[model samples]
Target: MGLIELPAELRLNIYEYFLLRHTRIKGGNQPNNSHLALARVCRTIHIEATPLLHTYISLRTEHQISKFVYHVDASRCNVVTWADVANDGRVMLTPQSSPVSRLFLALRKMTGLKCLRVFDCKSGVRAPDGPRFHGRVILKSEEAMFPDDGAMARSTPIETYKLCVSPTTRSTLFTNIPPTHICTLRLSGDCIFPDASDFSSLRELILDAVTGNHFDRRALDSTFTSSRLETFCYRMGGMGSLELRDSHLESLRTGIGTTIRRLALVGCSRLTGNGLAALFDQLRNLTYLALDMITVRQLQVGFIRVLSPKLELFKFAITNVSYAQPLIAEEVMLCDEIESLIDRDQPPQSMHLKLRDEVLQSSGRWAKWETMVKHRGIDLRTGVWGTEELQ
Candidate 1:
């Protein structure tokens, strides 16, 4: 029998294998030959596979959004479950502009969209006497684009939303949708910290490159205490450090320590050893932990011992080196401490340690450390430490 003559289940599996790859349509003009070929095979197959091909739609420019709004029919638009809007820092959406109004209209037409990501549109233009987000003009006039009774207002609730835009943009965008419907929220760049009432149903919260100054202590405490957050990750880049003090750890421990399963604090150099130890002691449920760019003083054997008991996977990095001490001696002392930890009777299930390449080159004992860890049936990894983009 021919490929199309196979069982319906088998045909669908085959189509999914091929069509899923083209789901994330990037540029406005790029065409998927495979999708087109499959569609051309037969009318029945096309009807079955077209929905899968339109599952994810990514528009990176205003032109792409415009073209998509005008060209794609309602059926294709309705099947998009995930949509990403990442303009190239050029197109500014001013209030009362026809393009801006049309853009919101197009967004409302995606009846099936569950996840939406909007970011990277850092325009320099400023609107006079208009609403602004992170110093960027988001509106040109006072008229509302997404009215309270519009189609977008009554559309399916968004479950996941990632915003890296300005404060005005965020406020304007959320005006139409109920914040309680959001389960996962990822905020980056200069976006303001979300209000306590904004995401009551949030389970996973990711803050990328967000600084400490953005958070209000009362709001932070409210979020940690009120929301049912299970996984929280805070990542910072460059030389900037998040001002996470002992009080923050106290809030985390008292609020979600028992429920949180995965925790990552990267580039939070302001945290002290005592605070980390106390926090880890309470977070007995955590299975995955990532700590990067923490202060060298916090790398104590007691902290490691406290952390090893519960974590299934641990990612640790040493980025804050003490220049007051001899570099080589400091490296040797740190490596020796790690070696001693590996030699312990019971180590973490898996540990990824990131160190300076120069330190690794100078020390020959890392090879022995790896072997010893392996002999103990522990998965140990070592690599050069550096900044990486958070995807």
Candidate 2:
């Protein structure tokens, strides 16, 4: 049937479901093809989903963010409760203008925001301040866009505040965060502790840092302890050397106590086998434990040998190419001869050897290599292999 045959309620429902499936408020950069496609379906759908499009807005360019501010101010949808700028650390601040100011301007206009995540557009790019220096794209206007009490009033009621800035931008922006009305705070940067204000209302906390040494250890411990958070997540970035102390983990463990369920450590280089074992002893209610970039330690001999059976998910990757030789050497040292390696493991009779041969041959090794793991209950030879060889 054509557009006229469908009822208005049905059309609106379709738009709503489309938004539910496609509208990612927390991490999405912008409306996807589904959002754009829904608008093109018909003029009616366009009007219905326009508000959905505005519900979660992301403006990458300074120009786009400005335009969005104007549109929201004029239309006053007030339904756009989530706004994200500086997606994936691409925000640039100019000598005189700043993305944070632009964000401050846009946020002041959106009074209905319940969740806000601000990220630094400039992450790794560092240039000296000059006419041509590449930094966060700041506006040339020196004038404060926000009113005297505007920032405090609008942000006090915000329910969720997420900040993902670089070390530089974090130092400047978090210098004065409106005492948070937010119950959920996800911070991913370096040394960002909003002034020693009480976050008594906060229940969920997530900390992600590429550079861990940037923050003062003692002061951060005090902040985490004071907040009494319920669910806590501490994720190290891809750099792999981010320091995590037993005291911090213990503080986190003690603060959450019986409350924290899921804990994931990503790219942490310093976590030893003994440390993880000790930490696991404290987590009784912990359901999910994930360890990624365990590239720093020997899994088979070190941490995995001591890991808890309660762990639901475990992941590890290579720390560096330099470790590859040691891994191979370790494996080779255990087996005296190639034949000894092959003879050690025997396969069960029920399995087909040809299938095993194909699996082994994929790595450019001879099919006979299967004998190495055969004794470990893997069947490397089946009746089919004998029949084929007799032919």
Best by TM-score: 1
Per-residue lDDT over 1-391 for candidate 2, one digit per residue giving the tens place of the 0 to 100 score: 9654789788767767776656443342333334556677667767876776667665455666667667656455377777655533223444343334354566667777777666555322233456665444443111222334355656336677776555334332323345445577776545435446567667776666635454434534466444655566666654532466555666665554445555656555555555665666667555454454333335332333333334333232223234542344332222223223234332122322222233234445544455444445433333222211000
Q: In candidate 2, residue 236 scores what lDDT?
A: 60
- Go through the candidates in order and give the clash count of each: 4, 27
Off by over 4 Å in 2: 1-37, 43-51, 73-75, 87-102, 121-149, 166-168, 173-176, 212-216, 238-241, 256-258, 293-321, 324-391
Q: Estimate each model's TM-score.
A: 0.72, 0.60
Give the Å shift of residue 5 in candidate 2: 11
lDDT of 1 by residue, 41-126 (tens): 88888787766767767665556667777998998888888776653322244353232334455676788888876655433223
